[model samples]
Every structure is written in C-alpha cells, then in structure tokens.
Target: MKGLKKKRKWIILGAAAAAVVLISIIGASMNGAEVESAVVDKGQVIKLIKESGTVEAENTVVIAAKNSGEIRKVLVEEGDRVTAGSKLMESEVTSAQMDIKSLQSDLAGLQAQYNQAKNLADKNKTLYEQGALSYEDYNASNTAAKQLSAQISSLSYTIKSYEESSGAAGVTAPINGTVTEVFIKAGETVTAGASLFEISDLSNIYVKVDLIAEDADLVQVGDPVKVYNEDAGFTDENCKVRKIHVKAQEKMSDLGINQKRVTIEIALSQSTALRLGSNLDIEISVDQRENAVRVSDKAVFELENKDYVYVVSDGKAVLREVELGLEGEDFIEVLSGLEEGDVIILSPEDEIQEGTKVKV
Candidate 1:
C-alpha cells in the first residue's frame, strides 16, 4: 500500500508539470491543469511469428539412367518442357541386346528338353497302368518332366525380363515439368541412379523457414502465411503452412543465442516472379482477434509487475488495474478493466495521484 501511494504521489506531481509553462512561449494557459487523454477504441490485433528463409523448388524430379552405359543421344536439352514418360536421352544398349539374345537361345534349348521329358512321362504313365512299368519308374519320369518344365518356364521369364529391360536404358521424364539441368551429354557415360536431368514444375514453390521449437508447435499445417520481398514489392497471400518438420535443429542466432529450431515448409504462389533460392521475409499468422479493445503502450504503466492505467472520470484520475493479453509494439490488448470510449491519460505523466483533477 505504501509503495502504491508513493507511485501516485510522483505521478500527480508530473501532472502538475503538464500544466506548467514548459512551453510558456507558445502562449499556453498556465492556470489550467493541461493534460492529454485518448478515447479507448476497439481494433484488430494479430499474433504473428516472423522469420526469414529462402524459396526453394518443391517436388523437383530427377531423371536417372536405368542402366550404366554411355549416353547414345540426348533427346531433350535443359530448359525443355517435357511430359511424363517423354524420352530425355538414349543409353548405349548394344550390350543389353546381346545379353537378351544369349538368354533367348538358352530358353529355346530348355523348351526342347521339356517337350521330350513330357513325352517320356506320358509313356511311363501308360506303361505303369498296363503293369509293364514299375511305380517307382513312373514317378521318376513324371518328376523329371515337371523339373524340366519348371526350368523352361524360369528361363523363358528371364529372357522376357531381359528384353523389357533392354529398352529401359533409355531415360525418360518421370513427370511433366521444365528441365532445369541436364547432367549427361551425348557419348558421356552415366551409371544407374546417376542423375541425368533435373526437372522443376515451378507451379508451386516453397519457402523453407525455421521457427523456434516452442513456436513451431503452435503453428500447424494449412495456416495462412505472408511472404514479402521488400525490394521487389512482392507479396503472396496464398502461401500456407504446408508442413512443420518434426526434427528440431540447433542454430545460433545473430545474438549468438542457441535456439532449437524446427523447419517449416510453406507453399508460395508462382506469381512471386522470383527465381528459386531467393530470400524473403515471412510472417506466420498464429492467432487473431477482431474488434478487440486496445490501449496505447504509453498509457499502461507497470506497478508491482502488473499493468495499471489512469482513466479520468468526472474531473478525477481513477487508477484501474488492467489485465493485458497481447503486448504489441505500439498498443496492447486490453483484456479487462477498460472499455470502448473510456478516456485514459496517454503516458500518464509520473506524479499523478488517484482522484487528482486535471484539465484535458
């Protein structure tokens, strides 16, 4: 109570100063207690988490060779628009063709043996039924026929598979997109799994941002985000929080503070008109309130770790404790102890006591 009284005493004195002629040269009245008051009003308040990150190509598709061989021809060049399954390049297929021919010959030989075994098995079955061949011999002949058939079928599939793969060495586009890069040239040797072309659709780009671990959990997929390039005056409202990475990485801030950051992926519109890998400022909208009662930060003074503002009522300053919600750079959310149209002293000068009278 004593501390509160002392704070009011200082504030009242400051109010008396507001009336004095610090600007007496301007012909201000020195007798009237001059003070400034603002009518509390309701406005929109939004909680935004801001971060900076770079735009990257999303859904980039890589075209690779199916076989390790020399590039016979490059059908499509870089920057070419291609559809799915469009041939990008042809690989050297001479060796693959020869391998398939050898398998085919082996398959033919196995088929002939299988036919002979089947004929023998049939004869043995008839002989055994007529009591001329033993049961054991009949079963052996049948088993031999079945084994030959199995070998022939297996070899035939192998030959068919080889034939199919002989054409696979020709690299094709896996998706419809613009080719951003081509890694193989005519007569250049490229191994399987080696990237021969890189294609990007550019229909949708993503801005990869990192947020602190705590903030990451607050934002979710499908939340709207704003991205802006100040120099270019470009902004995209269609950007949405597409993904929040589960892994958190440790990063050092400009202040050298260690922060656990989780990467967030947001999709931006194709209209940014900027190249991939460009950097931009982004703000993620976490929460919003419409027509929320707000007061200027200058008016809310802290006392005992609490916020208090003075409202003038009937020629007296009424001290009221306020519950604040969002602390903005210019104004704060007034959750309680204030209402619309109520007049509060703007940065209530120190030394203004409760019940003190001042002219607005």
Candidate 2:
C-alpha cells in the first residue's frame, strides 16, 4: 500500500510538469505574434486637389481710329493713367484741313452758279409772262436754278461731315482708366479701325479662370475665391465670383474632344498690389467642413468605387470604409468610419492587408 501511494504521487508530479511546459509554449507563441504585428507611425497626412489658371481685367478696351490717317502725335505712353475725354493720340491734321478746304471751295463755286441761275430764271419768267420769251426757255432756266441749289446743299452736307470727322482726329479715352498699351507711334500711318491703344479700368478687376465642367457646378456668381501671383508674393487676395460662363470652350487643337470649360470671373473684394493683365494662380474653395474628423489624403484608399482607410485597432489593421466630404489642400473630411482619437496609417504599405497585425 505504501509503494502504490508513492507511485501515485510521482504520477501527479509528472502531470503538473507537463501542464507548466504547455503554458510556457503558449506564452512564447503569443509574444512572437505580438512582435510581428508592429507598425511604424509616419507624420500627419493631408488631402488636397490642385488646379491652375490666370488673371484678367474686368473692363478692358482696345482704342482704335475711326478713319485712316497718319499719326501726327501720341498724347500718352504705355502705363500712363488717363481719364474719360483724355486725348491718347492724334492723327495728321493736314489731310483733314485740305479736305475741308476742298469742300468749301466746291460749295463756293456751287453757290455762285446758283445765284446766277436764279437771276437768269427770274428774268426769263418775267419775259415769258409778258410774251417776250418762249415757255421752253423759262422752263429750262427754272430747272437749271433748282439743280444748282441742290448741288450747293449736297456740298454743304459733305463739308459738315468732314468737319465732324476732323474734330475726332485725336483719339480720346472713352472711360476713366489707365493706358496699358500704345500700339502706334508718331508718324505711323494707321488704317481705319486699327487698334492704337488698350485702356483698362483697374478699380474693379476680374480674375478669369478656366475650370473643367465637372468642377464648375461648385462655382457660383457669389462664391468666394482666393487669388495669388507667385511672381508677386505669397499673400492671397480675396475675391468673389461675378460671372460663370455656361458654354464649354473647345480646345484649340483637338476638335473631337470638346473640353467643357467655363470662365469664372472673380471680382476682387479688396485691393491687391497685383497689376492688370498679371497672370495669377487661383484657388476656389468649393466646400468647407468645420471641426470635422479628417485625415491625410494618402491614408484614404479607393477600391471598387468605394473609399476606405486602414485603421489600427487592437494592434491589427482593420479596413474601415469611409464616406468622404469637403476635400481641401492636404486634408480630407472624414464623414464617417473614423473618430477623433482613431490611429490611421499615414501612408499604408502596399503589402498591408486587412486584419494584418500592426503597431503604431
């Protein structure tokens, strides 16, 4: 009986030793798995989309001559400030003067002939009434007098037209603005309707932006915009959309592919140091979300037309499909599937798979 009891105690000790070894092996395996799931955290990530465009004047004018003539004088130079009725240029006055003189001479000759015919017709009418001259002679004299009067009247009108045109021999600014361009030089001959200057009213300016049709819906007549000229500086000027073109402009080379682009005219709300015709890079905020959960753009992934992010949960990566909204520069608004305290991979490795162990 003593021998049997000692044997039973030895068997109990062996069983206890086996159980301790099993527990050690399981703990070692769990530790190895935990190490494999480690992940490295990168810096903050932001989501943004970028586009480019240019600036333009809201009111621009090309001053041209009304009649062909030699440029006698230029009253203004490029970059000169001018106002309405300010003379910008002048055409040769010699030709205008000669034209006026010739018309006057023609009028004088017609008037002398008309007077002589009137006297001749009056004398013939008196003679005919007293049977001293023939009816045919009186009629011929009357007709001659009337024809000469008509000729005099026509010449007078020609003279008046020349006078009016001569008054406008000098080109004048139509609006209060600055002369931005001077296309004519003194002694240069310009044709009728040739552009001689470009005047712009810079008090109110417009930034013209050509935007793709897909993005045009976000723009409206009153939406706010930001404009900047890198050549000028980093500070951006605030502006408001004044107009949105509905027609899609075609690309110059490819007629087949009609690029749906609309011109957005943005009015500057504040004065800017930028000059007229200066090319500007523009950014228009289509939407905004305040105090919303957001993440870096790279963190979000697209698959099968759905958006998602890999969130680190319990030392493992879990694919969290998210609804996105109000995307801006370097950041995207997380509409769903994320909380403020959630840890998401900045830039997930391509090899990262769903349910993979990760340490962040």
Give a tens-digit lDDT track for model 2, residues 1-360.
Answer: 999999999999999999999998677445423322222222333332235556566678997677787888888998888988888866776677777877788889889999999999999999999999999999999999999998888888877776666544357788888888899899999887789999988777667777777778777677667776676674455666788887978544234655767777777776764666567777676666667677777688888999988878876778989998766676777777787778777677765778766555
| Candidate 2 lDDT score at position 306 | 99
Residue 93 local lDDT, model 1: 59
Candidate 2 all-Cα RMSD = 13.2
lDDT agreement with native, every candidate: 0.82, 0.74
Tell me the lDDT of candidate 2.
0.74
Off by over 4 Å in 2: 1-53, 93-97, 101-168, 251-258
Cα-based TM-score, every candidate: 0.58, 0.65
Q: 283-340 in candidate 1: lDDT tens per residue?
A: 8888776788988888999899988999988877899999998866467889999999
On lDDT, the leading prediction is 1
**Predicted structure 1, TM vs. truth:** 0.58
Going through the candidates in the order shown, the clash numbers are: 8, 6
